[model samples]
Target chain A: MPSSATSNTNGHATSHTKALAKPTVNQTPNAWSFFAVPRPIKRIFDRFPLLTYPANRLPERVQRVKSADGHALFIWCAPEDASENRASFNPACLRWQAFLKSQNLQFHTVSSSNHASTNERLPFLVVNPSCSSPFKSNIVSAHELAKWAVDQKDSWPVELELHYEPYMSLLNNEIRRAWQYHMYLSPNFEAFTAPSYIHSQTNSSVVRITSSWELQKAAREDLMKSSPRIDVEGLYASADRAFFALDNLLKRKRRMVADVSAPSLLEATLFSYLFLLLELPLDRWLDNRLPEIARKYPELVELENTLKKQYGLQPPAIYDALTGTKDSTLNSRTRLEKHFGIR
Target chain B: MTSRLNLKIWPSGDGFPFPSLNVDCLAAIAYFQLLWRTTDNAVNWTIISDWDASQSPNGQFPVLSCSCEKEIAGILNIFQHVGSCDSINGHSDLNSWMNEDELADCTAWSSHVLTLGTQLLDLYLFITYENYYSTTRPAYTAFLPLYANYTIPPAHQKAAEKRTEHLGLATILGEIDDEPRMQPISLRTGGVDPSASASASFTEKIGFGNRKEILSKAQKRMRLESIVARFLEPLEELLGKKRYFLSNKSPSSLDALVLAYLSLILEVKVPDRWAAEIVENSKLTDWIKREAPHIYGNAPNKG
Candidate 1:
């Protein structure tokens, strides 16, 4: 019963709809109908198969599950550039899809073939850039499929959900903690670190469990909990996917290759390394550098337990020391030369 | 001389602006002070050449008096005081061979002061004289008032002006000076004939005596190669084998100072570039987060 309003900012008066009188859910209205589809999504549709793509064609590819009322989200993902085979699979898209799949609901992925991609889908979330969708930029941008959900909000049956994942460097640990401390201060949405980061410390294999009922059961049993493994997969997969996509995109265009120098590659590499480092568990790092930290940061102990349970780990060597072991006898230059083929 | 000095430093408690925060001198001072503190050595710490003299008592001691004779006198006075101090050993010369005790205890204070003070003085002189052709006149104006307050008033004032002008010319030559300046329009005032009063006065006022000879002598006196060799020897020794400066402890001010000087000097076009770089290049930047992580609101990477 949710009503929609045409954006007055653009002086467009025709598309106004009233709020849902018989509200089924507490959902925010879509404001992105006015803007163009995000650049990446547009590229996807433009490269859509000439014939209709089967709703369930890529079964393994589609990971999100349907909600209790049979509502599942969809996001359109495409290469940042045309003529590139690699798609920048956003981490959020993968997480959301995984969450949905765990719910065990029947859903459809309207791929590059779908022409009716709009933001009217109810309970259907869009992870588009904040401009073109109700969802904020932070979460969705890193996850193109999330952005697509926002871009195609009008096609779903339920309320639209928008999410924003901030750039990683923007939030330091304490600030991020403070943000989590007062998440409810904002009425519309919530924020979370990557699932892979939450799961990074443990060695558990997280098989997606579907259904709200099942999710609750798992939550009660502490079967699937916060661990760095999930975060490593989520964050690293997204960055790596994006990196490959960018790499593929750049390789195709002579202009970008000619213009982008060695520094840009190094910049990208640094970003990748920093993200990997940040995703690592502080407890493991602390154990190597200062054992006193385990006593000092109590949250780390709790986090360590959660990670151990999630990853099904029974205490392994800390990550840094594992890497540090290789460089013990051999110098860094030699190691880099041996492993990375760089001197 | 007054017996006991009670110093009230501005922006005090840990991070004070003395001896140029981005330079090696502060680190040397920190080490010396740390050593002095541990040993319970009694040293007279005074306010000298503070950027803001008005912040000090009577607004005189902190000023770097400009008169050539006065500056030279000031230099001599410090040496004389150090010589008189019971802490300093007066007998030893660099040319003589030294025993372990003599090296460690005999001239600890004087030798330390001499080595550190010489570096600072050389840096100051480099910024003031040889590099003056690239410096601006306004920045040097701070020393004017200090020069005016010296024992020999006019002489000190003139020396201050000379140093300022010398520095100004060096700055105009576009070298070590990094102070922001007004952008004047480019005009071909066409080459001024030397006979013209303006050109003649400009030459007479700005020119230094026997420039090449002075530079060669200064270079020899300072032993640039030796200092650079020593300065880089530690780093070179650790290169490719170790990461971060100082093999053991978390980065200290000394690390930042050395790194800042090298980084900043390499990128002189950026005003305060060298100073800022010293803070940026190594683990020093992250040390700020490590020591006081809450201030920046981030946990340091132990990895």
Candidate 2:
């Protein structure tokens, strides 16, 4: 009765009827006809074997992963083409892919946005069932996927395990702050990151603007949490110290690769942050400090180059934009100038 | 074995297990009761309506104290915590009708309501001078001592103003005023009066800023109407003829959220009833009226 009254006044009476009509039947039922499905038919439909789809299906030969902005979720390192190493712009996705590659796990990349993710984040992993396990394909991300890898015995050795939490905290806190500040809070957000990353995640202009605002607000709040106010100078100062510490750590060992023959979890995490910072087109926004670190630190640059070769990651197009590399066809200089108003 | 769960909310001026005055407390209680009824969980929850929020973990209510002595603050956190507990039933029968896609839709719609609906509520109750002075301020500070009543309302108003500014809606709507503008009539009369030459001079000194403020406020109110319209139209379309917002099945959490906001907007009496009038014209009013008795166990008296 309430539905009828509301529908009549709201001018949705027709649509209401249409909404209730199942697609296959295409017959509009009366207002009270929700109970029209006979009890025997319901029972028979429930018991029908063909009607029920089996929960488990054959595992896919390759794993499918979703990244933000429909970019490939892996570093594309073509031996023949050094420029092809830059595929995905998302550092988190690159980190995840690099970690998987370091473990010698085989995965195929697919372009997807954060909207497809269960957690509304980028870089989710989908594991296909193998002959050894009958479990269906499972989608996991973040800590859950990390745990899955651990369960499969693809984890850091005990020596590196002691340093995992400390190093992770370092990267998550100091390095993450710098990254968020560089990407979201910086003035370039409205010009570059917003259009390139955030806007591409959604088609709706309202959602895009609102989401960008919320994301920036969250980043600001996070930055403010450590201090009374946002001290950009102090933040960068600490960031410089953090980078310095990381540079020293990597410099001492020639590479972060330990005696276990596999790259430690620390190396994976470090590479994730370092590669993102070194590769991103934040040259215009950044105050020359981080870029200076990449230039001055031989070990850091060497590690990045080594990882690019190891993972077969093609340099992303953003790399060309940052380096002012001119292409014969598109002319990168003109494109940057026209779009970003940079001469 | 059933575990003892205690829910602490803001104390009500009137003695009631659930206060109808505070919309958040009402919604929290409604959400708790709905979950309790739909699940086979042995949750012996006692509503401590008189509890103060100061003792809470985050200095806000409603706080849920679980059997494990972990205090979860805020309604969302409390719900998530309780839902994750082993004692409570994992899945609600209300949500069983929805598929994964429908559930995702429900979440998106629920977020929309929470964000826009709360902003609308804030605008109606706190930003508009008429409603703030006549209704919201009194509702929050009436029970306090004279000194506290006088002090707290302005503080609360300032905080609300700050929040609106942070959300950027205030700037877009042009409500960011450093000081309240003097009336043009006061300036005009002072300038015209022969004996009040000094007052006239003072009026002239501040008149430009005052005029801009008045004009901006007028412009903002007009713009606010369109913003509210944009928010409501999509929600109305999504609801369509379904009993719930996004699902044809039983009421989900999104239903509870919609019911909470709609009921609050309709039932709460305020001087600036622009938002309430808008709600009255929509199908949401009828939905709230229909669901009130079932959710709250008693029909809420419309203000």
Question: What is the number of backbone collisions in each predicted candidate, taken in the order shown?
Answer: 77, 13
Where's the lowest-lDDT run of ten residues in candidate 1 chain A?
A158-167
Number of colliding residue pairs in model 1:
77
Among the numbered candidates, top lDDT falls to 2
The regions of model 2 sitting more than 4 angstroms off are A1-343, B12-22, B39-43, B89-98, B143-156, B166-222, B297-303
Give the Cα error of residue A223 in candidate 1, in Å.
Answer: 79
DockQ of 2: 0.01
Top candidate (TM-score): 2
True contacts kept of each: 0.00, 0.00
TM-score of chain A of each: 0.22, 0.65
Superposed by TM-score, candidate 2 places the C-alpha of residue B214 at a distance from the truth, in angstroms, of 13
**Which runs in model 1 stand beyond 4 Å of their true positions?**
A1-343, B1-32, B39-44, B48-84, B87-139, B146-230, B233-303
TM-score of each: 0.21, 0.43
